[model samples]
Target: MNPWLPAAPCAPGTCAAHTGRTRLRPVAAALLLAGCAWVLAGALGAPFLPLFGPTRRERLIRRWSYGAVRAFGVRVRVTGAPVPPAGTPGTLVVANHISWLDIPLVAAVLPGRMLAKREIRQWPVLGPLAARGGTLFVDRDRLRALPATVRALAAAMRGGSRVVVFPEGTTWCGRGPGGRFGPAAFQAAIDADATVLPVRIGYRVTGHGAAAPAERHAPAGAAAFVGDDPLPASLWRVVRAAGLTAELHVLQPVPAGALPDRRALARRAQRAVASESANRSPESVHH
Candidate 1:
């Protein structure tokens, strides 16, 4: 149960296969050591540092995250880079969820206030820091409070602060029974007629060991995700195993004005994201 070893191939298909790391292990380790220490200094210990400017703080957090991924020896290869013009009104950036590392990966690429579940706000070291990042926390089951969260997001957009939301509501390694996406989830945008940009996240797995998913009693891989977890517990094994290459691909952007109703727009954008996603389920990957 080594945190550095890669994930063991078990109970899994080719959805998001990932393996191999020796080549970049040292660099990844250095990034993590330096990046985590920097972010922790900024995030941990009560009150958090008084971030003078959101822009400056955003850069610090983002640089730390990108360093984290690279330090993990995880290569990110974005495709169809989303090039949204600057000075545009705050738009809603919607995307699908993949690994736990996803939050940092995408955020490193784009800076936008995130909409995350209330659970994330309770995380030990990262929780308080995320709150300071201006992320909107919500109790998913609180239908009554749902409106409030949506409104807050809308308000942020109106105020010129972009927002990112995962309407699917939960994470699934991007496979098997995708959590339902609330059709009206983007109602605020439709209400304000604001622009909604759909983003997609995918993890590419490679190599032999990358082909297995441990069983129910899979010797503590997922559970080993407590502290020092952005890099999965299985990372070291996966790295030592060999023959692996993972590439990240960011899809094209969809203009809100071009689509019809919010539902239709959501569906079209969903398809675009799924298509552009490299981790599409094995069965669907063939399509």
Candidate 2:
């Protein structure tokens, strides 16, 4: 295994058990169709995204992202001020990785060029869409390519694009300690003198007011797509889940140069995201 590859202990058998109420098969099928159609629509329309100005493009991206998650039967509750608008001298949006749903959830609020693994560029439907949407792909297995990836990220940010990255380098179960934020992406922010916006994503299964002991821990895991879990299985689980709410906690933005180094910057953003663990109560407000 490459030393740079990040892994999480969370797995389908151990961490992705869905104990909450699930939707009927028919309902889940309908939701699955809608979600897939919405995603396809986005892919088909991606080529024209550059025709619109920044503000309008941002609006379209946000609206499409919202619809995508809603089609998957996931309700999103956003907190904190909206992300800094485009043309703000570039912003690096960092968040924890959980489910595949996290992609649309974050884009709904802060639509930007995503920093993704290079292997995604070869995936079936999402590959072309990601490329058209200007995703930055980094080859994680090649340790020597680190500097080039950082340069590309810096160039994108310098061009005034908000680049979204999951700096932990892998997905987690979102119940315990998330992996540490790698410092490579933070170096791009430092190089471009861009602001770092940290967002925390949490999920909870609703309609479980009086849940049993086994079902109590079903919130985050219901939507977790960690380890070697297949994509279709995770999607089916999400569509069938009852009243799954995805919470986006948009924490304060750390101003450019606030931290002296990439490690310091990574630590600051990680701390902001980790703070959301304290707000894990079920009755948290939504906006």
Show model 2 residue runs off by greater than 4 Å: 208-218, 276-287
Off by over 4 Å in 1: 1-39, 42-57, 85-87, 175-180, 206-248, 276-287
User: How close is every model to the real structure, measured as TM-score?
Assistant: 0.68, 0.93
Question: Taking the tens digit of each residue's C-alpha lDDT, what string does model 1 give over 49-137?
Answer: 35336666556666766665555445454545544644457677777654556666766766678888787898776788789777889
How does model 1 fare in lDDT?
0.56
Sequence-dependent TM-score of model 2: 0.93
Using lDDT, give the best candidate's number: 2
lDDT of 2 by residue, 1-287 (tens): 69658889889888887777789999999999999999999999999999998889889999999999999999888766555655676899999998888888988888889999898899877899889888999888899999999999999999988999999999998887699999999999999999999988888776645653234334557799989899899999999888788888788889759988999999998988988453444433444
Error of 1 at 49 (Å): 7.6
